[model samples]
Target: MSMVINKQLPLPVLLKEEYPLPPWAAQAKVRRDEEIRKIFTGESDKFIVLIGPCSADNEDAVCDYVSRLAKLGEQLSQRLMLIPRIYTNKPRTTGEGYKGMLHQPEPDKAPDLLAGITAIRKMHIRAIVETGLTAADEMLYPENRSYLDDLLSYEAVGARSVEDQQHRLTASSLDIPVGMKNPTSGDFSVMLNSVTAAQHPHNFIYRGNDVTTSGNPLAHVILRGGVDKYGACMPNYHYEDLVRLLEMYEKRPLENPAAIIDVNHSNSNKQHKEQIRIVSEVLHSRNYNPKLKKLIKGVMVESYLEEGCQTIGGEHIYGKSITDPCLGWEDTQRLLYKIAENC
Candidate 1:
């Protein structure tokens, strides 16, 4: 004879959905799809600029910044395609600091993840509907993609997670253009692998169920520099390096031949001011290298209303970053004009 033991089920918790997008979100999505199609079809030669704060912690600040960017985007529509980075989540190196608006809406208080996630989604939707400008964000959590997948024009798989199979698979199914950064060690092989993985169809388990992907044909590469024991930035947008990388990319068939150069992070050696100088350098080099020029599409910069960064758990200064230091609005504007003139 056998005896059975019963376990009690957990109690249900009712949470409010605090953030929801307005009706205009649908129209914005349609425009974004048209823009993406133009980019991939060679109908648009405009440089795609992904610019914004290191992390979007405040909704009002981000909205103000995007409003300004959208106006400038309209003024420079012929030369550049602006995609404001509305990144609401941050991936940590050691699992410390405020992760993003999705984890702590109040900052340093009890976590209200339900509210945080909703807040982020609502903000993303607002960026598109209110400004009529496309948005870009780093996809950290695979499950979170569904929340804003319909609103984003572009997505980035950061250096830290580019090598992960799950992330690569997730990229395959993404509806918008995806950019995969090279590994932290500055190796291009991982990114190449990522591009290959994202270009082909994939089948995987998702949300406790089986799913298949038709692959993201618009997937591309982002050179954000890399680090090693010597702590130097890898592939410094040099003529030789860009030539070699493009050769490799051409030798093997890829979903897309274009690449986005990130002017921040290891590329600028983490110096906020260096972003402008690096952009100028790349533009100059691209002028002489035809092959490199053809493969290069645009650039990425981390900028905010103010320059530099702040302590995450410390007093809130507002408009500054809690992670990496960013270029101020004035400098960011100057850089944009310079790229337009040079490119």
Candidate 2:
């Protein structure tokens, strides 16, 4: 009863037509999707590191960061799959702040949905064609998935959005692996239940039309740590925490019972530097237990060309995060190599 219609944007189909992905890039995406899906399905031993800027605010910087990842991906192709996190959609918990490139293509500029849509599409397409990479994005807005679905190899349901019905249903319809993160409450059952919902067939209203999905067997869990009632970070990436997840998975019928540990977020208590230690420990846990290794496929790292974050509307620092702080490039490269060696 209290809303303003700012503009009637074009549908996803029209947007796709306006900015089409090249045939070669589309083919590349197909192969990348298959390869990444295998990792989630337990068919590949390769580990995935979804690393990049916290929010893809600048096209040139994000692409430059991903270009470096493409080289690293080739260097460790056999053991690691470096999927850059070109996240255009961001969830603002308090309903304010920089919501990501999808809200404003430029961080300091006014929100322009039309230009933002164009910017995100162009950036994603460039990553595929120029760098030979298919990136991951957060499904912050379930209704907007179709806009860039063809370009994404992996998608994630944020801890805040995991419990939403639309997000669960959207994950069910997606063809690529969709990560359902444990909620802020850190309830294992909530995350597992969302995965179950996403792995089952459903007929639902999507984009104002009735749609039926065959269901996505690659729906899995992401442990990003959680927040307690008193607002303290509670980690669950320890060996015992993973063992609990394994036992829970054993009792569920969820397909592709996999978990990706988010190295930043609550897991690191937002200390960007702690990502290195978290990754090392998780990798060690996998080595200690073979079964745990299979269930824990990979990790998500928030990193960029520069270390840490800067406030939006202030003087911009190229390749640094404007949202959450991220690990810097030098540290990221060294740590990635360390992970590959251990893997």
Candidate 3:
């Protein structure tokens, strides 16, 4: 007798059931939703500062940073909104290095995804509930979004994933505001295209099922710089670039005309110190340009309790980043005050 195949069998499982969000997470969701509404309504002119470690590899370090950030946020609440970057998942360029807390919660032990996810969620909840502050994170894996979606007030689509159809659909369905970064290769067209795609209703398959999105009007652009023809990074937040981008948005209105300037990444060429100067320069340039000033909504920066970064597997160092170098606490304070003064 010939053997028969069973086509009805489910695909082999890659992961187990997800852990439910803790009580703190539920409280955080309510708080974040209010802040998101204020941001989109233009009632809050405060520039959102999404500052934290390049990757949240240490739970204690992240919490310490947030505790300090919470105080600064209180002082600057009148002029700026502080959204701590509790980024638990990081996208790799060459797909190497530790992915993030979700992959390597225990530094040495083998990957315990369940433990990692739970640890990250706990950290995020603590930052929001204990510190009483909203948080921001880049959405990398689409399926993992729901785990932290309810707790986030702001979401970002990294340059590498901006043009992906799945991400655009994801953004459209998000209740929080989403910032789309320029393409990794330094193209504004792709960013604008992402905005268009994210702002319009879309019908697509989601998790083995069909779904339709009502479109996300809060989706906007984030000028994080692009690469030059000679392979050098170019900052797109300059007055000329900002003007051109605003003009492009005006001509082809998608979700919103506003944009956020990322002071780190290619914009600062990964130089943590230059982030402050670059942001100040952008502010000065915008002050001189009437139209540009109105379109620029906020700024994004990477900061941590301490300056610079250390290797993940190297000697355990407190406060330093394990992925990208960041502005130290002192510089972060100065930047926050400067932005408030400028406003």
For each candidate, give its TM-score against the true structure: 0.91, 0.98, 0.90
Off by over 4 Å in 3: 1-28
- Give a tens-digit lDDT track for model 3, residues 42-135: 6666666777888888888898899998898888888777788888888998997778888789755576666776677777777766787768
- Highest-TM-score candidate: 2
Model 2: per-residue Cα lDDT over 1-343, one tens digit each: 7999999999999999999999888998888888888888778899888889889989999999999989987988888999899999888889888888888997788899988888899999998888999999999999887899889999999999999999999899999999999999999999999999999989999999999988899999999999999999999999999999999999997777899999889999999999999999999999999999899989999999999999987678888899899999999989989999997
Kindly indicate the candidate among 1 and 2 with the higher TM-score. Answer: 2
For each candidate in turn, give its C-alpha RMSD to the true structure in angstroms: 4.6, 0.9, 4.6
* Best prediction by lDDT: 2
Over 1-343, each residue of candidate 1 has an lDDT whose tens digit, in order, gives 5975443322111111234445576776677677865775467777778899999988888988999999988888888888899888888889977888888886667656667767777787677767987688889987676666766888999999899999999999987888999889988888889999998899999756699999988888999888988876665566666777898897888856888899888888889898888888888778888766677888899999989998867678778887899998998888888888888
Ranking by TM-score: 2, 1, 3
Clashes in model 2: which pairs? none
Clashing pairs in 3: 186-226
Clashes of each: 0, 0, 1
